[model samples]
Target: MSLTPSSSTAPAAADPLTPLLTELESALGSVQAALSQRDALALERHAASVQRLMTDALREGRERGRGGDLTPALRQRLAAAGAQVAAQRAALGRATAALDRAIDVLMPPEPLGLYGQSGRTLRQRSSGDVASA
Candidate 1:
């Protein structure tokens, strides 16, 4: 195997871990991009978004009936994968919720105006003119 570096993409002149960190940051950015508008913990993917992706996969596998001899093993793998997916989904929820809460705290709602006060209708500032909400 040739050890020569590829010429198309040059490496940055920084610590080795720097590139790793940058890659991680980019990955995090991508994950953040996947987040829903109202939630930082929740991801919205249309292609194949599922809390139990493996369960769905296993279901599909069984529907297809592709294998006969490996059924037991397949079921076992499916169960294990389902468990892991469940754990990961729960973890993902917690992490995303925490991120949402952090963001909420960091970007609290702007102070409410007179209309912002709960149950109060909007009125002209000095009551000299008619106002609308």
Candidate 2:
């Protein structure tokens, strides 16, 4: 037989994860956008969509008997997304801490009194009264 491509061989099927990965990428980008815009409702909605997409992707992978066996490029993209989320979270945390510090400085807490209450009595007493003693 001549060394040539066989007509009987069919083309490889497209990867099932491609669409899921694409959707996930879009959702992650939306989440980042919402974060940057400080849009709580949009952020929450996109975050939930991201979570659902991850679950669906996991289910698809497991169904295909390829649990956690993602291609290198896909894994790299996931890692980058995770790093981006982590960086955003860290920045938010730092901002919150700074705000807390600023608020504390602006409105200091009241100091505790010696008797654990304000330095005042409800009733005054005369010196010779037994209640005064």
Strongest candidate by lDDT: 2
What lDDT, from 0 to 1, does candidate 2 have?
0.65
Q: TM-score for all predictions?
A: 0.39, 0.57
Tens digits of per-residue lDDT, candidate 1, 1-133, equal 2335543233334223233333433433444455434444444442134433433455554664564433464456445555644655676689767866775576455457633755233222322232432
Best of the candidates, TM-score: 2
TM-score of candidate 2 against the unseen true structure: 0.57
Model 1, stretches more than 4 Å misplaced? 1-56, 64-70, 114-133
Q: Relative to the unseen true structure, what is the C-alpha lDDT of residue 12 in candidate 2, on a scale of 0 to 100?
A: 16
lDDT of each: 0.46, 0.65
Q: What are the clashing pairs of model 2?
A: none
Tens-digit lDDT track of model 2 for 33-105: 9878988899889989988887776666556546544667766665665676677678768867886677557
